[model samples]
Target: MSFMPPWFWLLLALLFFSALAGWVLQRGLKKQALSADANDVQRQANRRIQQQHLTDLDQALAEGRLSPAQHAMARDDMLRHVLSDATAAQGNGMRPQVNAASAGPVRVVWIVLCLAALSGWSYAQLGAAQTWWPLPLSQRVQITATTPEQLAEQTRAWQQATQSRPADAQAWLTLARLHAAQNQHALAEQALARVLVLAPEHDLWVERAQMKALSAGGVFAGEPWQWIQQVLTAQPLHLNALVLAGSAAWSEKRHDAARAYWQQALGLVPADSDAAQGLQQALAQATEMPKLAEAQASQVVPVLTPTPSGGDTRPLIQGEVRVTPEVQSQIGAGASLFVYAVAEEGSRRPVAIWRSTPTAWPVRFGLSDSMGMGAPPVLSSLAQVRLVARISKTGSAQKQPDDWQVELEGVKTGVQGVVLNITGR
Candidate 1:
């Protein structure tokens, strides 16, 4: 066998001795108590039965079924209805019946001690208390842990630590989180309690409440709703939380909520942008689209401003006509330029608001304003469009050509949806 720790071995030795001692003591007690109970029982039997019972009692006494003195005591006690079940004394009824002259407190103390020890040893002859180690206590008395021993240690340490320094509420809260994650529901809740005790402020209360409610053993199934109320109570516009709460004004379909969030995002972005693109989708599905009806109402109204006709009637051979960055509208090179407009939407195909007269140093090499219209281009519908803009580098649309294409290269700058491409040579 493996060697045990010093304490274990000592414990085993102590227990073995204690067990032997207890066995002897208990056997004696059992015998004494049984004897007493038998006496009591016999006395009771005598008192209750008529002379017919005397036969049984006489026979029991003769057969040694009952001790003579025991029988006499039982018989007397039964007749007088008095209890005479005291243990046998050694010398006298009183503590050694000390003489008045010698009855010092010290002597009395000695006599008392002797009587107590005698009583205890005599009592053990009948029955005894269980044995246990005095110095080394039971670790089993400690808290629950991974294993019985481990749990005992953990419990012991926790108790000892708590005795030395009470648990902090923050510490409890963190422990609660860890336990909750582990599905240690009860432990998690206990930790949460500590948290509340330590920090009962509104924020902490709310946090504790959330953990308690959401905790496995916690009221989670019931708490998320209450937690939601708190979150909204503090920050109503919390995007995701509120969204999750359900669009109160609307149904489960988060159209309004989604729209609002998307709009919020869209406002901070540039047009023709990815955000704008997303917003466009949002608008399509928004309930507030009607509220924003004015937005789309005018959106369909085409973005083409009328091409301002210049006084020039010349097929002006202009310098390089460069297109505007985002919108493919052309700005002239010289002091003068022409302009044009295409019908709305598709306008037969991708038509320019207007084309510019040719020149050198076109920032874009190929047919930058590139998209092909069929053989003879047809207007998409009666849509307003940017035909062209013939203008000077001075940012001026001079009134000069009346005969040339008299286009926007010959017109004023206004709203125009120019369809142009730089790489589509």
Candidate 2:
């Protein structure tokens, strides 16, 4: 349920109370005016009676029925009575005026107090009182800090919301996107899995496959490959799936397959688009290479190695990844560990990537030009590079919260082997 802002309700209450106070003051003024009018009528009646008495006395004196002393005494008595009645009427009128004036202010004070109490109570019950706090200017700067605290908070909120509304596929999809962006691939995959369960669609499956490939550092095999295959089976010309399939084929050195997939993708994309331009370049490069025999196209390309008799003598860097006992317990079964070399400058793509199981900690690996992801600018071409060893519980090379990682920077190519410790960092 959506809630209104406290200020909105407060303003509404103020308007309502002001209207009510005005109504009370208006009623009081009307009553006071009526009382004053009644007092005036009574004063007029008393003057009339006094005038009649004087006329009666004058008539008696003119007829010689009353003596002069009697007339004077009667007039003086009527004057006293008339004066007393006028004084009483004036007092009655003033009392109502004073009470009406005082009633307005008193009623306003009471109304204000009541409205304030009601506002407080309503806000406490309806608003986010516990979470609400004043955000000072000093605290605003910290919100932009490059740490996982804010992301973690958002993840928790999304998790709670997803749990509360399990049937909300869009919420689950959004949660998946958030987790994926934060490099929480395991949670992200879990959320996507939920979305698939709730609402299975071609685009979602393709997205899942893309995430799978990204988590594996652009390698698509096993389950990730199957995801793309499923989408292609349903819709062969699906743009995203085709692109991912092409990338996977390229990574595996299946140039013919990659070319075919990319050509199909190029057809779907706009001719002037960046993707089309890149695909055109790749296609041109593929056309220059000798065509593979049909039988070779169906088979996986074998990793060629130099024979001991006449092998290429380029140097190779050797390394071992070590995991501390404290962090070893945190590593789950089937978790992937990536040890790779990236160029310090120009195209930070991994020159060579090696994957290992978490249980095989302290495993030895070799980095050479032969292990390069693609042709050109191999490990030997770069004067220096950074060697990174990461333990990915989500199987993603991207860093996630609580992942163990270690890097050795400025390591010269063809140098002595270095040891990297995958301690939590």
Candidate 3:
């Protein structure tokens, strides 16, 4: 049912009571008027009877049926009774008092009270009684925030709302989108996690995956890719999921996979819409990227300067990441390749990381100090490093069963040529 405000019901009640009270009072007044008319008719009939008796006495006296004294006494008696009736009729005006209980004002008051009670009871039963009281501050919806101050206030309000009503999945979803809008990907992912627990719809799964990927700097590895896979498995033709999957492939340089996903999604959207136009543009870009890559392939490695600034003259670690033909045949177009270098000792965090799709075998790869994860422990600072290349079956950084991997340990930084053949897991 659609929501109705409290004042609307109250006003409707008042109008109904007014109409009913007017009707009841009118009925009572009409009854009293009918009773008064009946009494007036009876008074008139009594006067007529007294007049006929006086007339008969006069006739009798004229016919010598009675003496003058008798006639005079009878006539005087009749006249006195007629005068008394007139005085009494004059004393009691047009409407005689019928009953105190049947008064118009009393009936109106009773009607008002009864109607008020009935309205209150009916509203309590059929209407939203909570609307009669103010809602809690946290439960109230905030207007769209335009300014930073307003955004902060709205964020706090939504946070309080989620805290107060922890099971409200819609509230959590809204808060997640709000955080996403403000570019707070980590916070958005956290809020989306609540939504996943409370209401794990397919669309929300795609949204959570997107938020998580954004939090991980546009890398759809591990959990994010898993979420996307779950959604695609459930709803193969879901439009938003298709779009997101295409974008994820595009991010991993899987142009063919990206083009396929976008093509499917493009068919679902309206031809003239902005979404369709965007998909078309992405498809066009994906189509041209492979050609560009092939054109620049020969010139790519030779153009790289072999020396470094800071008086360190050492070539970067250049390598070929290859997969066996049998294993390559089993890989899908969307599979991801991770070539990274970590320190020989200490933390396993990659000092340098590069990601791409292994569409072709024996791919040229390069790693240098500049390719580090923008943190401490530069690649050049390490004496020796562990060079690892792996092909993820699920297009994720994390390894799973049946993936292909190869590792080269004790590889010095700035190694001239390295070949890592990804064998079967």
**Number of the top-ranking candidate, with TM-score as the measure:** 2
TM-score per candidate, chains pooled: 0.20, 0.43, 0.39
* lDDT sort, best first: 3, 2, 1
Best by lDDT: 3
Q: Candidate 2 at 257: error in angstroms?
A: 0.8
Which residue runs does candidate 3 get wrong by more than 4 Å?
Answer: 1-143, 298-425
Backbone clash count for every predicted candidate, in the order shown:
63, 0, 0
For candidate 1, write residues 1-425 as lDDT tens digits.
23344445544654565555555655654555555556656656655674555566678899999999877876775545333322232222322222332333344455445555664565457533223222211111222233336544554455455455565543344445445333344565566567656654344434444445323211233554465457657765543333323322122234566456445545656788754664454445355433443453544322221221222121211122344343233433333333323433221122223223334323221111111111112222222343443343442222222312212322212323333222211
Ranking by TM-score: 2, 3, 1
Error of 3 at 401 (Å): 38
Give the TM-score (vs. native) of candidate 3: 0.39
Pairs that collide in candidate 3 are none
lDDT of 2 by residue, 220-321 (tens): 788888998988998999887887787677678687887898789889988998667766766654554334333234544332211111132456677677
Per-residue error (Å), model 1, residue 383: 51
**Cα misplacement distance, residue 52 of candidate 3 (Å):** 58
In candidate 2, stretches whose alpha carbon ends up further than 4 angstroms from where it belongs are 1-147, 213-223, 280-336, 340-352, 356-388, 391-403, 407-421
What tens-digit string does per-residue lDDT give for candidate 3 at 80-165?
88888778877877546566335777777777777777877787788775666555322342336545477677788889999999
Worst 10 residues of 1 by lDDT: 366-375
